[model samples]
Target: MWARRRAARQERLDRVAAEAIAEFEARVSSMLATADESHQALLELRELLARELADINGLLAPGGGMPVEMVRAQLEPGDDALAQMDRISAEFTAVRVQVIGKGAADRETLVPLLEDLGGFVEGMGELADNVFGAAEATTELRVNLQDARKDLAPLRARLQPALRAAEDELAATRGAPGWHVRQVALATLGDRLAALEEGRVWPTPEKTTVDLYQELEHELATLRDEIAQTPS
Candidate 1:
């Protein structure tokens, strides 16, 4: 009967899908893990740089919302990284369901998909990926983190180097307002720069990288004279 034939066909498909689904589910798990790691790194970078920027802005007082609030308005890279990762998750889920939907009976043609997915999840162990392959899941997230690094470069090039010159004029001043040189500043600035110097910024201990945030609550405490504040 027609029902019997249909039942047999469905059973064949279920059998064929078992092993392929297991292999692909394993790959999907790896992809999700990579996405997660990238997402967290991007979030940390945004917070670190934006906090520094806020301190600089507070010191300069260009006449706007509170520096902490203004910091939020200017920063969008963290959100961008989140959005991109969400999209990748959606697409990966769709791919997971469809990848061997018809079963992997045709192994040769399926190799490309498997390879591309591997490259994305694990970075291909190469300096350069294939010319026409899917970018690793974290590529944009890495870019966002890099852009955050760039955000702080102006501090070194324009702010810190020039800060020392104005100290003499400010030396006799009282309190922080009369002295732009006594700006509230991040003590972790040097440490952050060193971590980013090698073009990567992970595995850094919280204390070693940005433990001064609590100290920031007492902004006046960090408002040292320029002579003491200048980067060596």
Candidate 2:
């Protein structure tokens, strides 16, 4: 009877321990999901920045008042967030292996790691905000170009040509993969542009709208450039 009692107690202890680990892992997964969402936002912002700069490069006249070198300078802020995310990704993978992948015991150390990760996620968001004068990099570039032009009438008129150009590219390849995403980006960018204020007080966008089309335009675009590269 004593032996059976001991076995039952051991079994209960084991089950309780397993439930604890499962709870811990669920918490960890939720936290890491936040990072994944943030990382993707950084990626889309980086790609959009690259595309807008390239677009501006295409639009500028030779010896155009703005040099490509000048236009490209804006990418600096967001790159750090991307680099930090890469490091976090590696460390996160290692932690995940211990907590969930191997079905191992939860480490007391991981609690500290989780706190640090949460902090890193917050910092990355702040860094991304520095790069966004608006949702897509398009309006940021537009404002830069507008500043050089120094006239709202001409600048406002020029505001949407790039957007129209992007839409036309997607329209040409209707029903193609990533087409829907490009369409959403158009809407996001348009909404952002319409939201622009007269004082040009560029608002810092929420860094967590990973829910936005920015990333969904997944397998996505530099729009015209990507579409051009796509073989008919």
Candidate 3:
């Protein structure tokens, strides 16, 4: 009978130990999951910062007019981003404290802390969106600038010859009827060419350099025809 009682007591102790071990493992698992979430949030923040830096670098590349200091100043993260980072860091530290201090014996403290961690993760996600949103805008601006340059290429090619022709016409028709008109037209064309070369006239989606060049080409052609018909 004593032997049987001892076996029953041994079984109860084993079951209690098993339950305690399971509970401890569960707490550890929760802690690890919280840590992993915090780590992911940090990684996302880092990626966003890197992207912003890359955009600033592009603005400071060759032929770029945006000042490096201005771009760096604009790209600096705002207070919200910094605050989110600090909060996440604090939460991670809290999690570590819970792990070391409680050692699975204290479950209540970690539950609320985990909940706070979740909120922090959500905040971090929102902050990342705000950070990346600015980068996206800069990217769009760069694309528009590139397209403007593309539109200007052919226009520049056609304008060079037109400018030479205008100069030649002015010299050939000196002191003739409507010579002053031709000279004035040539001056106007020269101004436009200079503006384009100096980047004063930027082609937009609404008003492309292609359209402007076509209009100028037509005007120059009409001027040439008029000059040809006039008697010498």
Candidate 4:
């Protein structure tokens, strides 16, 4: 009877852990997809800007002649494209800082907590296996298992809410208008900048997008390892 009860409890623990892992993976997948889309969008915008610049240079160099002052005049700061680009760029930077800095930092706090949970589950599974396979399940093993379950209960209770909160935050970040708005602004800015700075090479914004994407991907991978390390 005691063995049967212990087995039932162990099943429950396993079920809870499995559910938590599934929820976590789903959330991470959604977040990663959003990040990937954002990175791609930024890359496309950067390329579009480069092409616009090239086009401007081609137009300006009619018969291989240059009109630098005219190009500068065309690229005045007050131009609609530049103004819009500046605004969107500022917004994009602000959003990126929030997402990459605060958002990532907040998620980082969860990684260690998850690792702790995973470790607890593994410890419990080993204890269960040892005790159940023995000639007689010992009182000490039962006590230890009970204590482990007690410790794990609160973590399991906390996991769902914490995961939900993270999911909400990620969704908000993904749905922010600034990301889309910035794309349009970048396209316009690229056209204006190209015309103004014809034949001058400028750095691409894709580097920042790639960096942020990689950072987020690394974090996700670490979290995945933690989840996988947990005993089923």
Candidate 5:
């Protein structure tokens, strides 16, 4: 009877973990898409500015072989506009570069988090296998599994701060088109990952483990759907 109950619980655990994975995957996809769009938008802005500069330079060209100073005189009137455009372009370029760098950093930081979560999920799978494969599962083995879960908790917790920072940075730059969608995706990913970490870390009974896991699964599923619905 206990074995049957354990099998049922394992099924539930697997279901939740699968749901969480689906959600995390979707959010990551959304973030990458946003980064791509932002990059293209920055390129367009640069191209437009370049075209304006070329047009203005042509207009200020020396006519009738006028003196260089005379050409300079012709250009002086619109110099402020050129300067302002230069300044705006520089600022926009900087923001674009920063956003790209942030995206790369976010990916780097998230890799470890994903690995850590993978470990937790793997541990759960192994525990479930052992529980079912054994002729009879022992209390001692269950205790050891609990200890393993605890060990995994601290590593997962360590990632929360980094995850929070990535989310915050992503959110701070949401004024641009498509950026707001990415911010939402990043925030959702952070929250889901944190919940997974918490599910492992919480000092709860084995019986309650499935409940925590299922809750995280539900949260992740919702996040995934929301991300999919988010406009690019």
Candidate 6:
């Protein structure tokens, strides 16, 4: 009887200890879950940052001048960057898994890992914000400038031909258009002609929009002459 009584007491003690351990693990799991949330947030932010940086790099490359929104839309599609953020968040969920796998007795071993994960999360968030913000700013500026250039195109085209024609007529007439006529014509043509001469004009394929076609042809002939003179 005494032996049976001692066995029962020992079993009760073991059960109590097991319950204590389980409760401790439950608390740890909750804390780990919160940390995982933060880690996931940081990973998402980093992914978004990387994606934006890539987009801006592509935009800033040679022969690439599309608007920011358009480029962004093309990259992200319907769900946009948010979808990518979600994907990154999911990818970092393994941190939570790792922490949750720790036993009650493993708290000492697990705490440092959880802390490191948190630190990594904070660092990633900072890095992502910095890179994304800079690239976004640069891309926005470029897009705005491109939009302004687009707005100026029609005026540039209309004014260009008239200015070139006036300059040509004045040149052909050997400045004989008289002092007042010459002054008025040159003044009227100066702004647009100067802009053209400075190469601020937009691209217009063929000779259709340009008054300097014949002049360009002459220049091309001169270039051919120079090439011909060079030793083969």
Candidate of highest TM-score: 3
- In candidate 1, stretches whose alpha carbon ends up further than 4 angstroms from where it belongs are 1-13, 62-232
Q: Could you tell me the lDDT of residue 230 within candidate 5?
A: 45
Tens digits of lDDT, candidate 3, 1-232: 9999999999999999789868866867775676677567666666655555565456454333222344355455533454556666676667656655664545676567656556665665675566567546555644554565566567667778877876886688788988887788778877876654543555555756556666777777787777767677
lDDT of 4 by residue, 16-64 (tens): 9777767766654555455445444443443444444444444444322
| Worst lDDT 10-window in candidate 2 | 207-216
- What is candidate 1's local distance difference test score? 0.42
TM agreement with the true structure for every prediction: 0.28, 0.47, 0.50, 0.32, 0.29, 0.43
Error of 6 at 157 (Å): 5.1
lDDT of candidate 5 at residue 94, scale 0 to 100: 53
Candidate closer to the true structure by lDDT (higher is better), 1 or 3 = 3
| RMSD of each candidate relative to the true structure | 15.5, 21.0, 7.3, 35.9, 38.1, 12.7
Q: Between candidates 3 and 6, which one is better according to TM-score? A: 3
lDDT of 4: 0.42
TM-score of 1: 0.28
Candidate 2, 139-193: lDDT as tens digits: 5665656554443334445445656766677788777777777678667766654
Q: Over 4 Å off in model 6, which ranges?
A: 1-5, 47-105, 121-146, 152-232
Q: Which stretches of candidate 3 lie over 4 Å from their true place?
A: 1-123, 131-148, 202-204
Candidate closest to the true structure, highest lDDT: 3
TM-score of 3: 0.50
RMSD of 1: 15.5
Assess the local accuracy of residue 137 in candidate 1 as a C-alpha lDDT between 0 and 100: 25
- Candidate 2 lDDT (Cα, 0 to 1): 0.57
lDDT of 5 at 34: 52
- Cα error, candidate 1, residue 141 (Å): 25
lDDT of each: 0.42, 0.57, 0.63, 0.42, 0.47, 0.53
Better of 1 and 6 by lDDT: 6
TM-score of candidate 6 versus the correct structure, residues matched by position? 0.43
Clash tally, candidates in order: 0, 0, 0, 0, 0, 0
Worst 10 residues of 4 by lDDT: 131-140
